[model samples]
Target: MQAYKQSLKHETFSYLPQMTPEQVRRQIAYALAQGWNPAVEHTERGTPAKESYWYMWKLPMFGEQSVDAVLAEIEACHREFPNHMVRFVAYDNYAQSQGLTFVVYR
Candidate 1:
């Protein structure tokens, strides 16, 4: 008999304990300090491999200095899509690519 292996999807900050609201705010603040734009995205299925499409909350908040605004947007997204997985993304304009991302709500 062959041994069974279970595969689990892994993401950034997955190993850490569930983040509190304050922790999330700190992350957003870090992104802003790094000069990265903050954005919110959600996926119904919440499977990054299978669910290739993720809907953006509104738009990438570029040049945003207010961590409160970013946190508010994250909360709003979660409220609107309670069933979906909400994620926080840090986009780097200079690199023209995503810098960091983590599932904020699952």
Candidate 2:
């Protein structure tokens, strides 16, 4: 199933714990190609929350790709950033817009 819903809006971002800063940026770009929004470090996390979380913007069809259908492609992209927690979301896009942000993780 797709990681995101067609009518819901979601956003997610995070700092790569096991990845280089450049790797993080590349990962986000891969996500966008597959339909996802990547954000930079927490803009409001001056300190720390219960569990450090990154802010992000999500589209309606961020991850609607099917496993049996898109697994190959997804896996190929996943190679860009290994050993890292990935944040993904899908939102509804009524205007058919392709806006995305690929923020590098530190």
Candidate 3:
């Protein structure tokens, strides 16, 4: 029998259907409504888990109230790092932890 091999993709939401732009907008709205700070990050394609720390696109967008603003940043990151995997992360200050995270570009 041939050996089974797992796919290298281990990013969050990788198994789910790729999110449409509208879905992503909704998710960003939800995070904003919850008062979570949005942040953009990017990692090189096929980056190993041992070097999983993605580079931040910029400072976390604290007090951001518009979903479009967050989406714009994601797009900017994608434009700058067209070949990298871009991700969206929401930080919950009340809980002092990450609340939502998903790859937005790959």
The TM-score leader among the candidates is 3
What TM-score, to 2 decimals, does candidate 3 have?
Answer: 0.88
- Model 3, total clashes: 0
Candidates in order, TM-scores: namely: 0.83, 0.27, 0.88
Model 2 poorest 10 in a row by lDDT: 37-46
lDDT of each: 0.83, 0.36, 0.86
- Write one digit per residue (lDDT tens) for candidate 1, span 1-106: 7542222333587667888988888888899999999999988754456445678999999899999999899999999999887899999999998888888986
Off by over 4 Å in 1: 1-10, 46-50
Which model scores highest in lDDT? 3
Residue 70 Cα positional deviation in candidate 3, in Å, after optimal superposition? 0.5
Which sections of candidate 2 miss by over 4 Å? 1-17, 40-49, 52-106
**Candidate 1 clash pair list:** none
Put the candidates in lDDT order, highest first.
Answer: 3, 1, 2
Residue 95's lDDT within candidate 1 is 97
In Å, residue 68's CA in model 2 sits off its true spot by: 31
**lDDT (0-100) at residue 95 of candidate 2?**
38
Q: Candidate 2's residue-wise lDDT over 1-106, tens digit each?
A: 5464322222333322444645644544565555543222222313334124544322233344443222333333345444322343322254344344322222
Deviation of model 2 at 94, angstroms: 11
